[model samples]
Target: MTGGHSGRQAYTGVPRWLYALAVLAALVVVLPLAAMVARVNWANFIPLVTSAPALAALGLSLRTAAASTALCIVLGVPLAVVLARGRFPLLGLLRSLVLLPLVLPPVVGGIALLYTFGRQGLLGSTLEVLGLQIAFSTAAVVLAQTFVALPFLVVSLEGALRTGGQRYEAVAATLGASPGTVFRRVTLPLVLPGLASGAVLSFARSLGEFGATLTFAGSLQGVTRTLPLEIYLQRETDPDAAVALSLVLVAVAVAVVALAYRRPGGRGPDGKAGKQASGERPTTAAAPGGALT
Candidate 1:
């Protein structure tokens, strides 16, 4: 195909009417954000967002989101690898259960957590005996966030693992690399981008978590109340503050998602940027052996 024709086909291959639908889809997302921005009280946006309650909620949200994302990475990576690479009975059932949070109501998850950790709950009494109270506390908030956000990381990394296949892994094993060495040198590197993207998505999901945190951990200023819960509370009393905080959340989420998709060295998918666009042929190195070494 001619370069210009190929470029045109890249975008126009879909049905002509789909372009209109695509525009409508974009509008559905953009219009609400536009209205929110328009409603923001620009005059007091700074003061409103900087208020003590707002700052506390934002700080709490950031801290819990970070903690939850770390937890998701530690736990979800292994789960994803198992789902994608391991063979066993009822594997499909296990995979579905792991991804349940993606579709389950946040409130239901919270209630389940509450029953597991609340006083008189299945494990709560046992925990209480050990003096480790969890429900209605900051730790509950982290658990709630992790419960809901874990699926995002798992889904992302599992898809990446499946897409990447086991070619490099097999090659590394053939070259005398141990399983751990192959994973560290071959599998992890191949899936690093997906893992990073998944972690960012998990952080974003945790940052916005509300129903689970509220139902399991009760909203308390500077404790379990995250920015979403703060926005909910402020909406009833001070819409201006709510709007300001919403904008802050939106901005942070946008920045994080942008960072997740950003390419190394700021190059586009076509690899056309800076001196690389000046006809320097990219070189490919030998795989497996060099990587295992």
Candidate 2:
């Protein structure tokens, strides 16, 4: 009666323990970040960042991450289209398998890659016949990064496909547009924001990949020592340098999240992608969806 009289019933119903748990979670994430920021010595921040080793790691990470992002795009786009548009048995299982890397321990993933693609492993003999080597090389770094980052791209694009729905694609088919043409013109353009966000998130994930690279690629300087690897190495020898490198990663992560969430084409915050170009009323996509009708 007291809560109703004061119009505070809603607030009263929220369990105090739940509020406490939320605060605890916030502190768990924030306190460590605050500590890292506090440890940063601004006086020599520029020097620490510009040091030769740091620069080499940064350059290598950027290179591998970019390559990995490209790989994710090439592979993820089609996979997303299939997953969204295809209605098959085990669809949910397939999605879970696609997203496994996101939840898998990075070390475990690295080990799996090592055994699956290692020189003495399953595909080793076949690769040797072709004069190709993957283990402990820059190629391996890119492979590892791609393995870990691909799920982000696929998940993002698939969600976009679902949200955009099959309505426009269906209409496009009705208009006599070839499947390829409709995909290129109507579907891709409509989901450009999803693609962009996915790419960015994939890039960020690749940039920070550490355990996989260390295990599969062996962390050679300028060859496989990504920024995160460098940060780990620096922590043992130089804590300040480690903090500086961490700051760079933290900054990059923030930028990536910002880019992914930003409104597309002057749309409001909630306007995920611009209105459907198909101009037909947007409808919830039914099962069996793809970019092409």
Candidate 3:
């Protein structure tokens, strides 16, 4: 028996207010983006980008954002796995704490970082003993970006992990697969869509990071003046350049997110493929949770 249509079901009983709210939300973002796009000096866009300061800031932003995203992948994945599968008594609290950065004001986060890593701060003396400094440096920008962007990766991966559950992993273990093998062959593939989406988002967040970077890394050209900081400096003297830089950032972020997010909706080598590869009927795991006893 085939359903009449296997695609999107038309919304029939939706409230009109919901539509109104959706439009409002769309406008909230769209209006600002539209205004920025309209304000861009397209004719001078190339020169603006190639300008020494612009180039330096853009390059720094790209490198720091990439470094931050990479750091997120390294640290966030384990955190996600733990959050997804652990049965600790304080698991919920742990998750809340991990996600705290998302809600914390960026400036406050910068201040927190300053106190924790500043030359005269907590670990400062210890680092000083090692002759390594972190405060007001390129490293600080990377750290600030990583701190702010980590929650995005962790939350996305956790949700995907939860949605994926541990059924495939259990089956692999039952079939004599080692934990490492199951994780590499089963777990990683299952949550890849989320991973990609999260990475893109984190990169976007890192690219736009301003508050924390400014508070922690000070705007030193060629050292830590990332795109946003550069734009801020330019805005007062050259509004056109600022507008152009904003447009460039928005374009890149939009493109990256669109590409990564599009993968989830497509039938591809993603979560469902793992189940098919294992020749098992799908299980409704429902959440990243502790293994079945």
Every model: Cα RMSD to truth: 4.5, 6.2, 5.4
Local accuracy by lDDT, each model: 0.87, 0.85, 0.85
Roughly what TM-score does model 2 have, to 2 decimal places?
Answer: 0.84
Return the top candidate by lDDT.
1
Candidate 3 accuracy as TM-score: 0.86
- What is the C-alpha local distance difference test score of candidate 2? 0.85
Q: Write the per-residue lDDT of candidate 2 for residues 239-285, one digit (tens) a residue.
A: 99999999999998888878877865655322265665335444333
Residue 108 shift from truth in candidate 2, angstroms: 0.9
lDDT of 1 by residue, 1-293 (tens): 66876766545358889999999999999999999999999999899999999999999999999999999999999899999999999999999999899999999999999999999789999999999999999999999999999999999889878876787678777767778877776777677778888999999999999999999999988899999999999999999999999999999999988876777675532223334233432222345655445
Q: Clashing residue pairs, candidate 2?
A: 85-289, 85-290
**For candidate 2, which ten residues in a row score worst on lDDT?**
284-293
Pick the TM-score winner: 1
Error of 1 at 280 (Å): 17
- Model 1 spans > 4 angstroms off: 1-12, 263-293
